[model samples]
Target chain A: MAQIRCTDLTLAYDGVTVADGIDFTVNAGDYLCIVGENGSGKSTLVRALLGLKAPTSGSITFGDGLTAKEIGYLPQQTEIQRDFPASVREVVLSGCIGRFGHSLFYTKLQKDLAAYHMERMGIADLAKKCYRELSGGQQQRVRLARALCATGKLLLLDEPTAGLDPIVSRELYSLIEHLHKTEKITVVMVSHDLEAVMHDASHILHLKKKQLFFGTREEYLDSEIGKTFLGGAGNA
Target chain B: MLEMVFEMFTYPFMLRALGVGVLVSLCAALLGVSLVLKRYSMIGDGLSHVGFGALAIAAVANLSPLKVAIPIVVIAAFFLLRLSENSRLKGDSAIAVISTSALALGVLVISVGGGVNTDLNSYMFGSIYAMSGEDVTLSLILSAVVLFLFLLFYTRIFAVTFDESFARASGVRVGLYNMLIAALTAVTIVLGMRMMGAMLISALIIFPALTSMRVFKTFRGVVISSAAVAVICFVVGITLSYLLDAPGGASVVLTNLAAMLLFSLIGMVRKS
Candidate 1:
């Protein structure tokens, strides 16, 4: 089943269209990478998909009446957020709040789930450590674990590798790829790191101002725009 | 110490003032942590000025200041909330515009009327000595309501504080929560005005929260510790005011500042 479907979607702020008339779909277990330059409505499109912003026109439907708690998201890091004083465990547990509501009481299962995800993300030892004190790569991993705790069926990540060392970026991409393969979860990611995204993406969606091109990796490799932007067919 | 307690209990106004100060401080401390986290420490300052303006106007018009101030401040807070969301006006600019204009208008109204018989000094710097039983009851009721709301919306509040966009994405109504916070802040400003007065009210809102941040890791811990700190400051400040015969509002703010400094020193020592 298609986990996400957007039909004739248009998004605008203050009546100026950023991206318009977009049509897209993601099947279960599909790994789709949205590649675009800055100000090309990449983030805007992701915001619309996450329901953070309403589309000016068109309909977006998720499979089986999936609520927000069923979709995990990793947003781009900001300096202010990095300086926020919360422990790693505390940060991750916040993801479960969608399920737990406003109650201070937490079920044993929820606590165990948070711990399990942290361990799975290889940050179990840093659970008690302050989030602000972690290395950039480590912080990103913890955020990923936090996102994963909320939902494993579908994940939306925006600029997950931006501003990180190339090695760390590669590791993050590899981790996402591993999750896609092992968990069979559908993933939609917005990223400027084309090489890493193109390497793992089964499907590529290229976005420019008011335009979108959706195709398989092979088709993207054959296209003139993709070839020019990505450097070569091999890279695509 | 025993004699001092007896002196305090013997005076009805003193007992009432203490009750009002402690209750308002507790509620302010709880909300203050979230306010600081959201980088809106100045909001309390802004709203209190609005409250003061309403109070001056109400005093001149022979209306109950509490009745007039509550709705006016709440409306002003709503306006500030909406203005902040405009993305055109920066957050601080919006706060400055609302607060300064409201305060200036208030001053104009007072001056035009040649000032009411009310002592502005007490309102400006807080005269906890003048608190009546009605003020104490109002403070208690407001604090209870605020506390209930905070507990009811704790999870959504945490989500919004951590990441507003994320909270909205998770099906929480971001606009509703923002307005709710603004309204609560307005209520806090009005309730606090009686104890700390307009001039020094925000200090009560900010100091305890900042001091607690040095040690607390979780949001809940911050709230708890902030309240504890605020209660300490209020009790100590009131006691000192009684002994020293100083201004109650200024004394409370000074006490809060000292506590902050002491905590910072203790934290430094631990770090070293």
Candidate 2:
């Protein structure tokens, strides 16, 4: 059974239709990559998936006992974070905020979860360090650890390596790949890194203001849209 | 200096002002950390301006200023939120427009009604004599409520301030928390405006947070230090006001400015 399924999803904001007729499903443990050009509604689709924005039409449903809150999310860095005053551990612990629901403080279980994720992400040593003082790659690791604290079932990443050196980006990608392979966690990533996507993803969903293609990675490589995107602008 | 300080505390009005000042300073400092982080620092200034307009109306009608200002300022805060979120006005511009208009309306009303009495001057510049016994009690209660709500939602506010999208994705009600911060800010502004003055009340919300951020590397450190900075500044400012017979609000603002400069110097020295 699919962990998440979207049917004929149409997303529009500010009276403008950014994308329409989007249909896809993620089976448990599937590695899905959403790819698109700029202004192609890729981020919008991510928002819709995360339940941050409502679709103008169609339905998104979770199966296999998956709830929306159970999805771990690693969003792109925002301007506020560039100078934010927060310890690494404090940020990671915030991810467990959803687990308890309106509780005043984190429990020992949540703290333990955060600590474990930090250790796994290779950021346990940086736990007491200020977040703003960390390097770009380390900050992403902190955020990835924070996301891991939210859920263990599935992970959604939107441009997780948006602004990092190539070596750092590769390291993050490998770390995510390691988590996916070892933990049996379903992964949905939005990315502009076509080479990485081709190498890492099991499935591809291409968007160009609409659903251009949705299929397995091999199938996507053979599809006309994927061939054009990969052969023309994408690094083949 | 010790005897003079001890003597200043003996007066009932000084004691009342001190009590209200401490609570307001604590509340402002707590909420200020989030507001400054979220870049909503000017909301305090904007709401205080709205409070000024409301106070002008209250004074003209012989009603309690707090009674009239609280709801209006809160509504203005919500309006600022909505305007920034939905309208083309954006954040800082919306604040500028609304706040200036409110300030103008206050000045116009004050000029038209009574030709600028000492009562009106006190609201604009803030005098220690401005706080009455009833006003002190009301201010203390409202300040306590502000402090309580801020503490209750501290974690969520930190999450929201740090990252709104992640907070929303984590199933945190980002909009609801944003509204909570705005409303609490509104109440704090109205409560402090009587003593801090409408023009300078925002200093209470901005200076301590910025000062603390200069030296503190973590949010918890900044928050704790911000509260301490605010209280110490308020105490010193009020003392200077009593000694030099300066305006209470101006004294406090200058003290905060000095603290900010001092912290920045310390931060730079530590870096070197």
All candidates' chain B TM-scores are 0.94, 0.95
Among all windows of ten consecutive residues in candidate 1 chain A, which has the lowest summed lDDT? A97-106
**DockQ of candidate 2 against the true complex:** 0.84
- Model 2 lDDT tens row, A11-102: 99997999999999999989999999899999999899888889999999999878888899998898889999999999999998788675
Tens digits of lDDT, candidate 1, B191-221: 7786687889998889998998776665667
Interface RMSD of 1: 2.3
DockQ of 1: 0.49
Off by over 4 Å in 2: B86-89, B115-119
Candidate 1 clash pair list: none
- Candidate 2 lDDT, tens digit per residue, B1-272? 78888999999888988888888898889889988997777778888889999999888777877888889988998988776656433777878988899989988888788843437777887767677888778777878787787778888888899988888988888899888878888988887888888889999999999999999999999999999999999999999998888888999999999999999999999999
Q: Where does candidate 2 clash, by residue pair?
A: none
Tell me the spans in candidate 1 whose CA falls farther than 4 Å from its real position. A64-69, A101-105, A232-236
